[model samples]
Target: METVEDVTRMHLVGGNLALDFVNTRTGPPVGPSDDDVLTGYPELVAWGAYAGVLTTSEAAALRRLSRDDPDGADATLSRALRTRDHLDEIFRPLAAGGAPSTSALARLRDDEADALGHAQLEGGSTYAWVWRADRTLARPLRPVVHAAVQLLTAGALDRVKGCGGCRFLFVDESKNRSRRWCSMDDCGTAEKMRRYVAARRVRARR
Candidate 1:
C-alpha cells in the first residue's frame, strides 16, 4: 500500500524545490497514465514535510484538519495539482527550449502573490521568507510558490532540464551543465541495460 503519511519514498531528483514538486508526477509528461505521488491531502502534507517545507507538527495538524474537513482538503489538493501543472507548463517547455503557455505563467504569477500574502519576511542577519498559519492546508505550497518564482528570476533558467529517460524535471547543477537522466541509479542504469540487451540480441541473430 502506498503510504499516505510518507512522501520521501518518491524520487526527489529535481534539485530545486519547485522542480521536485513538479517531479511528483511520473511517466510520460503528456500521457494519461502519468502517476501522481500526491493522491490526497495527507500525502500533500507528507510531501511538504519530505521536502522540508513543513514541520512534522505542521504536517500532523494538517492531517487532522483533513480528517475534520474533507471537502476543504479536496479543494486544497486540487489547487496544489493546478499549481503543479502550471509549473510543468513553465519548466517543461523551458527544458525543451520552448516557451510556456502565457496563461500558465499568469496563473503562477497570481499564485506567487497569494503565497506572499501568507508569508512574512523574517531573519536576524540574513532575511528569509517564512510562512504563517501552519494550520492552513495551503501552507506547504507557499514556499513552493516562492521557489518557483525564485528559480525563474535566478538567471539560471538554462540549467532547468527534463530527464532524457523520464518525465522528471531537474536543475542541471553540474559544473559543466552536462548532467542528463534523472539519476544514474534509475534511468541511466535502465538505459544501459537496454543497450546491452539489444547488443546481445544482435550478436545472437548473427
Candidate 2:
C-alpha cells in the first residue's frame, strides 16, 4: 500500500489523460500487485486534479461532498475502479495489435452513452461536458470515458505502449516511436541494471 505522500508524488508520464488514469496502480510488469494510488474517494479526487481531469477547486468540492455522503463516495470509487479495469482490458490488447473484448467495449459504450447527455457546445466549435456539482460521485468518470473514446477514434492505437517494467500503458510519442518503458529514471534505469547484472553473471559462469 502506498502512503499519502507516495500517492501525491505520482507524476503524469502517461502522455495522455486516459493512460494517466490507467496508471494509478503500480507494480511488476507480470502479475502486478494491486498497489493502487487512489485508495479512497479523496485520493481519487486528488488524482483527478493531478491528472488535469478536474480543477483543484473541483477536487476540493468533491472531497467535501464525499465527506457529506460516504456511501455515494464509495460507489463513485467502485465505478472509477471498474472504469480503470475496463480500460486496461481494452487498451492492452489494442496496443498489442489485438482486438478489445466485446464486454469491455460494451461497458465503455454504456459509460459514453451516459456521459453524452451532459455535454454542451462551448464557444461555437468547442465542446465541453458538465459534471453535476452536487452528490453525483460518478461525475468524474465522464471525462475519462470521453478521453478513451477520443484516443480510440483518433487511430493512434499503434502509439500506445506498455512499460517493460510495470506494464503501465503510455503513448510512445517519441520521434523514433521506440519508447519501451514508463520512465527512463524509473523502469529504464532498473532494466539496465538488471541486464548488466545478468551479463556479469554470464561472464562469471564462462
Candidate 3:
C-alpha cells in the first residue's frame, strides 16, 4: 500500500522536478542532494534499460547529463525530462495497444536500432560508453519502467520520484507509511538517533 507521498519520494526515472516532487523532509536532514542525483541516474537508466531497449546515444546523453555542472545542469535536466517523456508517451500507448497499429511500435523499434548502431560506432567498437551510465553506484531503477508499465497503463509519472532525503531514486515499498529517508539503514537510523538523544536531554532537564 504505497501512498502518494511514499511513491513520490522513492522513484525518479525522469527529471529534477521528479526529485523535488518527493521532497518530504522538514528538518536539516531533508531534501535530495545533488550528489544523490549524480549517483542515481545510473540506476534509473538501468531500470529503463531493463524496461525496454535504450539506444547508445540515449544512454550517452544520459551520461553527459550526469557530468558535473552547475549553471548548465538545468539544460541537462531538461533534456533528461524530454527524453523520458518521449519514452513514457511512446510506451504508454504501446502497453495499451492503442489504435491497433504496429506502425508506431515498428517505427520506434527501428529508430532505437538505428540509434544504437550509430552510438556503438561513435562510442567505439566495445560499446563501453553504454555502460558509463551503470558506474554511478546508485540504486538502479529496479525491474525497469517497461515492467512497471506492463503492470498498469497511464499511471502518474510522479510515482517515479527521487529521494526526499537524497537524489537516490527507489520504489517505495513501505507498508506502514513511514519511509521518509533515502535509506532506513542510513538517514532513518540517524534520525532515530537524534530523537533519542533529544529525548534523553529533555528527561535530564526535568
**CA lDDT of each prediction against the hidden true structure:** 0.87, 0.82, 0.39
Tens digits of per-residue lDDT, candidate 2, 128-173, equal: 5555442356667788888898898884889998888886889999
For all predicted structures, in order, the TM-scores are: 0.93, 0.89, 0.33
Error of 1 at 178 (Å): 1.6
Flag regions of model 1 displaced more than 4 Å: 29-33
TM-score of 3: 0.33
* Total clashes in model 3, counting residue pairs 3 or more apart in sequence or in different chains: 6
Compared with the true structure, what per-residue lDDT tens digits does model 3 show for residues 47-115?
Answer: 344334445565556556556543354443344444344444443343233431355445434434433
Tens-digit lDDT track of model 1 for 1-206: 34664468887899899999998888954555357788888888889999999888888888888889999999999999999989988999999988899998899999999888888889899998899554587888999989998999874898888887889989898999998899989888988999999999999999
* Best-fitting candidate, scored by TM-score: 1
Segments of candidate 2 deviating more than 4 angstroms: 124-135, 202-206
Alpha-carbon deviation at 6 in model 1, angstroms: 6.6
Model 2 lowest lDDT segment of ten = 127-136
Ranked by lDDT from best down, the candidates are 1, 2, 3
Model 1 RMSD in angstroms: 1.7
